[model samples]
Target: MLRFILNNDDIGTALPPGMLLLDFIRYHQHLPGTKIGCNEGDCGACTVLIGELQNWAMHYRSFTSCLTPLGNVRGKHVVTIEGINLPGSLTAVQYAMQECAATQCGFCTPGFVMSLTGFCLSHQAPTLTNAIAAIDGNICRCTGYKSIERAAARVAEILQPRNGTTPAQYAAGAQILPDYFVQIPARLRTLHSTLESADDVKAQPIGGGTDLYVQQHDALGKKALRFLYDQPALKGIRQEGNKCILGGATTVSDLLASPLLQAYFPYLNNYLKKVSSTQIRNMATIAGNFINASPIGDFSIFFLALDATLVLSDGRKERELPLRHLFKGYKQLNKSGDEYITRIWFNLPSQHTLFNFEKVSKRTHLDIASVNTAISITMQYDIINDIRISAGGVGPVPQLLKETARFMTGKLLTESLIREASFLLQTEVTPISDARGTEDYKRLLLAQLFKAHFITLFPQLETAILIR
Candidate 1:
């Protein structure tokens, strides 16, 4: 049985857990406000706010309904545009849209409203940048986005007086959302206490369902899947001694919010901004990215350069494997069918280490990468003491450029040395022609990205000299 609160209504249905929330909302519940656009997560036409009780307060995040499965919403509050409507007046978010004339054709309006409402109910500061970022996933084909930007600015101004109150309390008190939100925590506590646990060892393992729903949308509804997104054991980022540990189900948004990661990599937010949109990052999990095995997966290439390790479990036994060995071939993994990744850990970077990530894609944001690479190097007075380089979309699998790293180690940092190392990297992988780019283009792109790592890390090195 699937039980949850959907737009101020308690829902308990016998629908399959793998059934999509978009389908259930539009077809089953007869709510047409949440329009169906791109069935994939790319289009934000089906965006909704998912509120979960964390530490006795509701924390709401935007998620694309088309990519979200029914099982993922168990014991949580799911809010649609209808749920936030006032009796006879528009909420602050809706009024801002109307006042700014941000709607046209009215198809993508609900999604934009939901995303902006989510921003109002979030702890993020009420700034124009944050407001714009909140609606990055939504696309408007009619309005030139200047009006949407104006609306987002108005929403930020409306939220400027939030002070220090929790986002939910402030949103409710200010009429940005309904007053019923203030009562969700208590309702969720009762619901969670009575909920049954579904842990089937033989069932298919599903995390977040961000990618699986896209590839096997029709087949998943017929399969028995054990949802692992909310498992307590697989939902944290912690540090122990010299190693940083992360649960397999940790989402990219979790990393963005993590102070520990930010302290280690100050530019993490900038790098992640290029990874995907806010809605996709909020739902895409670390283990799911690794298991999806896309040749150009951003997280896969990022973690690969760190030489991360994974702990695999099969319910009865556990084992450890280096991430470098996890990829056997294109879309193939070096694990058993019953085995699932439980935890991922990597060594903490020291003061003497410099790390960088580079990617070339069709679009700067919210698009797949044509060539991506990351490098972690430990320097000993301008000489490379140790190094690890990983590249994607240049081979059959996400590759750890062992030969390139070996060639660079113990070498002095100079234009000629790096140039020689880049040449060696070209021979270490086999790239193929695809929609992203041609074979020669990827090779040239990888070489430039390889050079970019050094250029970014050592700006003192003349750019013209290296490129020439």
Candidate 2:
């Protein structure tokens, strides 16, 4: 059975652990405000706000109901459109959308409103950029985005003077939300104490359920699954000495919000923008990305270049392996089924080290890459001291271009040396033709991306001469 606070009411159910939250809300509970579009979480029509206690503070984030399992929300508060609706008055976000004429056919209105409301509850700066980012996962098919943008801007204006107050306090004081929200943190604390964690020993471990629910929804619906999304042991980003450690179940959203990563990878946000939408990132775990073994996983390729290692555990025992070595073949891993990734750690790059990542995809965002590559190099006096190049969508698995990396070490920073290494890279990858692109196109694209790494890291290197 699962116990949670649904909207304002506490509920328990005897449904299967893998049952989707969308079905539970719309079918069993009979709440229709959360629509069902693109049941695969891409459409974001089923967007809902989930509030969970973290370090004694309540943090709220938007999630796609379709991909979220019922077990994942155990002991947390799941807020739907009905939870935020005022009987005789409009919420700040709702009023903004209505005043700006943001609703078109009204099918996707609730989702946008919920996403925006989640933004309101977030502790982020009430800036236009952050407001716009909150709704990146939502898509309005009627070309009504301009009006929605206006609504978002208006909402940001309303939150300008939030001061240092809590979201519940500020929102309630401003009449954006009801006064009941102010007491939810204490309520959640009591409710959380009574709930026990799902035993993962005898069940399949699923984090976020974003990918698994999409790929194996039918099978998962009937399987006994253990939810890892809220496991305290598998959530956080911390630094120790020269290494940075990230819990396996940490989401992309968590990584983006992490100050440690932001400090080291100043362009972390820009690099992640090339990944999927906010909704996907909010639920997709870094461990899931690596274990999925997709040749084109963005996080997998990114971490590979950093020489990251995975800490694997079976609840009782633990082991560590280099991330690149975990992938043995196409969709194959060098890990036992019982052993799961618990943590990932990588050495921090020095000040002299240069890092670059690039990807070309069908769409600029929310699409799989045709080719993705990353390189981290340290040079002294124009001579390469150390370097690592990693790429995906060009081999059976996410590959560390060993031959190419070895050739660049101790070599002077010259167009000729990198040009020669690019040729060697092509030989290292065994790309095959598929729907994404032809085999030859992938080969040429990877070569260009390699040169792109150099051009991006060393702007002084002429692009024309480097490619030649």
Candidate 3:
């Protein structure tokens, strides 16, 4: 038996494995406001706002119905487009969609509206840049994005009066009963594990099923996996002392939107915003990207470059390890089936230090990286005091160029040395060819990227002062 809140009503849905939320809403509940587009989660047509209560406080986020399994919504809230706005009275978002004339074919309206709705609840009168981040996960091929931004902006301009200030809360006392498919032993639930600390949590640990579903649905790889999601543990990003701890389930969308994150680690958002389509970023987890361990995972490139570390834990114990030490060989990680990534720790650079991240991708959206570079340098009076350089989409793991950094620090910031250093990076990496780019291209780019970093460093070197 699974329980959740839907549209301020307590309800239960006995979901079976492989039952998609988009299908369940359209078929089981007979609600049609949530549209379905690509079943693979590429299009945001099936977008919905899912709510979770953490420490008795409620927060909301958007999800693609196409990729989210119905089972994942258990003990949560499901806010469909129909649930938020009434038949006659339009929401600020819906009314704005009408006022902006953002719809044409009608296939993508519900998703845009739902995404705008989530954005409206979470944001105030948003700027175009913020609007781009919020609606990036939602694509409308017919209307382009101009009208959609207008509709989204209108949410802040709504003139109607409201009934007090309480946003609709998904009720907690939901009715639940037994189902035939799968059930935990009553003893397991009775034990030490809380509902939030659900054991045997495999597929649900994943945020957006883009990767998981692609792995399962493609028939070329790991198939038929049920889920991965976290209600509390895998959700927020905050700093603890020297390191910034990002939840394993933190989304690219979250990283790009966070003011605190940008103030400290601006390069991550600046580079990752160029990664996947806004829809994919909204759902893909930073942890999942690392866990997937592709040599080319964009975030890994910057993370490894930034000298970030990752935390791994089984239900029993937890350990923190250097992110560069993660790969054993090609495509293998320190994580085992019994263990999972719990958090990522990136050392926040001081105000005076300079950190940079860049990636060469096949396309601006939904393309794999050919080569990625991260560089951090502390300089004083035209001499390099300290430096760290890491590369991604280049080797088996995001490789730390320790020897290269060692050879360069305390050296004169000269043009000749920068050129020689670029050549040294080419020797450090081994490349593999795939659909995105060739091995030769990666090697060539790695060398060029090194040159770019040095150019940025040398000019600042003479003018900049080391923190005394």
Backbone clash count for every predicted candidate, in the order shown: 0, 0, 11
Give the Cα error of residue 242 in candidate 1, in Å.
0.5
Model 3 RMSD in angstroms: 7.3
For each candidate, the alpha-carbon lDDT, in order, equals 0.92, 0.91, 0.68
List, residue by residue over 416-462, the lDDT tens digit for candidate 3: 66766777777788888777668898888887777766555455533
- Residue 158, model 3: lDDT of 42
Native-referenced Cα lDDT, model 3: 0.68
- Ranking of models by TM-score: 1, 2, 3
Please give, for residues 24-134, the per-residue lDDT of candidate 1 as tens digits. Answer: 999998888998998889879999999998877788999999989898999999998889998898999999899999999899999999999999988999999999999
Clashing residue pairs in candidate 1 are none
How many pairs of residues in model 3 come into backbone collision? 11
Q: Which one wins by lDDT: 2 or 3?
A: 2
Once fitted onto the true fold, the runs of candidate 1 whose alpha carbons sit more than 4 angstroms away are 464-467
> Using lDDT as the measure, what is the rank order of every candidate, best first?
1, 2, 3
